[model samples]
Target: MKEDELHAFLTLQRIPNLGDTSIKRLIARFETAQQVLDQKKESLLKLDGIGAFKLKAFFEKEHRLAAEEELKFIQEHNIDYCSYKDQNYPERLKHCIDGPILLFKRGSKDFSQQRMISIVGTRKVTNHGVDFIKQFVEDLAPLNPLVVSGFAYGVDITAHRAALDQGLDTIAVLAHGLNQIYPKVHAKYVKPVEAQGAFITDFWSSDAFDRTNFLRRNRIIAGMSEATVVIESAEKGGSLVTADIANSYNRDVFAVPGRPGDAQSLGCNNLIKTQKAQLITSAADLIYLLNWQIEEELKPVQKQLFVELNAEEKVICNFLSDVGKEQLDLIALHCKMPTFKVASILLNMELKGVVRPLPGKQFELT
Candidate 1:
């Protein structure tokens, strides 16, 4: 909780006159933070990126006490400051371009894990997606991999909650700092996650929840994880950006399939069909695709299609899945059959475990 090293780092970050590229230039010449700060105006003028104008701007805006206050706040809150030199820094992310000079974390769990997976998707999830998430988490949790997510609503929240529910550590990579949590409604779940996992960010406490931070944070999620799974997403969504980043880093990407008509699922379906991601039907598929080893033995559930109806059952299953449950009359119209025959077929299908009959003569694909 001491603040000296953190305060110096924060002070260097707040130097308005110098950007990350410029800092790199300066660091290449200087040995330590103190050495760079101690250099006189004459020595500072010798740097390539720091000319007279920027040098003047740097000194004019410099305030030691303000930087000290930011450091104090971080310490008072029990937030840990991890530098590039910190052994605990994630090695995968360290090699990433535009990597942060430091990271701020609030949690008991280590960010470095042997196996890591990031789950990202749309904020508005469908009932179909909820079932996908539950099954995925239950299967992967036993592997003891670090599950990372944005902690947003829908798929993001669902993945995090499921990981925690299964007694696995899950990291919530925040857009802002630990100073304040965005989408405040999630506060109830966020706190307990810290005790078991972590909330991490590249920005310091002073950085606001700006638009660019979210995009910047996406890289961390991709960098830290070995692979990413997009459960459900829109054509244009933040989750796609993470998948792109993961692909750029040569990490594997997977997407769950949904009906083509489902708007929320279109993104995932497109990704798989377009060959941008592998098609994942179950958590077993993901484990196999990633070649992840589970400590506990995992056996794929044998699926048996019962009561063959002379090609009719296959057509009905595909039809209902695409358009959702169908009433007896609607099914007869779509299948071009008589209502009485449709009812009889549906009853037979239900008895054979091919479909589930609902109230009002509606039938669902099992």
Candidate 2:
């Protein structure tokens, strides 16, 4: 089925008050959306959150209207979507306990990669935090990692634009939908990213961009990545929420150590002091923490494996080997291949175990 249709179906199953946790448990018993729809009202009455009162509302005409409204928004905005059952859905996010039932997307790039990192922090950043972002991004930009972040002010926006400037595929996770880019000032970058990177959200376009949604979106950012980096966060900033989720997900959490008395750095310091986050001085620290080890000997072997490239594959492999890892979309953009063809070759290479997938659709030469 078309992905949007599947998304609508899943959205229907996970209406207000019925979250991913409950939806997952329900699906575990039923085989398909139709089965869930066909389930007897009495049977649903036995389910914990779905008592007779809720079950009646679920199968009502209003419920279908809500789903249709969501679908219409998806179609009109050119916002692609994926349900948890779809292969295109991010595996890392799918593994998350509260992964969204519907992911609203607007971009040519893939969200699921092997080496994903989420960079977050206070909206009111200090100079030190800005410098850290600039330098960290310069080093990380060349590596082409799929940098994930909220499209908020401060450190989050800084990281996204930097990755774009470095010609990397950066995905912004939104609490809203493709139809309305929150903090509308970021609208310009959103289009370019839609062409080059990606824009992902869980809430339908019809849904308001509520305060609670951005808080919920932070968990997706943390859960989808291999690690979460807080450039500089205030005592009560949203970055701390992302860090907390990262810790709970067992994903690495790193913070840029900042000077004392900097209000923006308080949350970061608190995290490190409490042993909640590791101190990171550079992108190398992140590279090391992820244990993305590519031995020196693997270089020659990689060269030999793709020996028949007409100078192009040789160049790409050389870049990849030296760089360690890169988003596959960046590779295809760099190699000038259609995304589908690049995906095909990467899949082949993966099957041969020649390369490994990283979070954010990145691939690293082994």
Candidate 3:
């Protein structure tokens, strides 16, 4: 949008009582934010869902001033933004009633075309949770889905790192403005994230950082994705909130089932029991339920074991390639290597994300 148009949308966003949905309604009737602002109270009050209270603060001059200030900060920082009405707005988010009218971003990603999955969980993640996320991401890599998550601790960071590691595009839905990164420690991963995807938000540079910001941000995470997955969650937490939002949007919701007695699993189990989310054991179940086809080329993370493998590792990989999954002993025997030596090589391969160890001493390419 041009400067005046962008400023008008930002001005609409800055109004206190006027929310995205109401603003969208007003914009629909008047055709533009500027026109809406120019409209008379008599005409505005005549519109459905429009009342005197909603417009009480609508004509405040400070709204436009705040918008201009935010626009200046955006330009100064070189932040990229998109209007909800613009063709470049997130396609799935367009379906949401309360989707933000203006979204700020910094990165090269274009959500104009993509398959996104929002993965959220407690910051206090378990070892099992990490393993599940990594493996699930690896399995989903073939379809090349853009993983979406908050840039918080545990599952969010793990999901983002795993996606970048797989060379998949990912988007971090931020709770605050683009000018800052939350949980300052997560700062290290920002560059890599931006290189591969982006950090998107609706807050202006001057907006206050508050706990409520997270709940509001969850909608975008849920709104933009085709599905929302809860890797782990306590009985009450943000991930569950995200699942609720996804369900409200009529998006597919999946939660990994954990032991009933486990504290972190309680939320997911409840979701399953309540039928708020589908129970998925792995990415395969999610893929099947969503009917997502692997239309893109298989990512290296999905197929290649090692970008450049050692001769011994290559021998084992080739053997597995020829004979398919086999027991460690069988693999060692067939490759003409001692059991101890083969075991060590396989362990190294697993660390490099080339192989996955299975039950009964079996192994297979990741």
Error of 1 at 117 (Å): 0.7
* Number of the top TM-score candidate: 3
Better of 1 and 2 by lDDT: 1
Better of 1 and 3 by lDDT: 3
Sort by TM-score, top down from the best: 3, 2, 1
Stretches of candidate 2 exceeding 4 Å from the true structure: 2-14, 294-366
**Over the stretch 46-81, how does candidate 3's per-residue lDDT look in tens digits?**
888778877777788998999889989999999998
Please report how far candidate 2 places residue 321 from its true position, in Å: 23
TM-score of 2: 0.78
For model 2, how does the per-residue alpha-carbon lDDT over 1-366 read when each residue is reduced to its tens digit? 564446446555546567777777777778566567778887888888887656666776776777777766766766677777788888888888888766778888886667788999988887777887888877665346788999888998998888887777788999876677779888778777877688888876666768888899998899888889999888887899999999998889999877788887789999999999998777756664565543333322233454344354455667688888998668888878765456546543544446666766688876
Whole-model alpha-carbon lDDT for candidate 2? 0.76
Q: How accurate is candidate 1 locally (lDDT)?
A: 0.77
Least well predicted 10-residue stretch by lDDT in candidate 3: 296-305
Q: Candidate 1, residues 1-366: lDDT per residue as tens digits? A: 235656656667777766554664565688655567667899998777778877765554455566787777876887776876568987787666556767888888886687889999999998888888987788666567788999888998899898988888899999987888878999998777988899998776777678878788898899888899999998888898898899888889999888888899889998888888998777756755565543323222223654456677667777888888987678878988765555545544554556665666577876
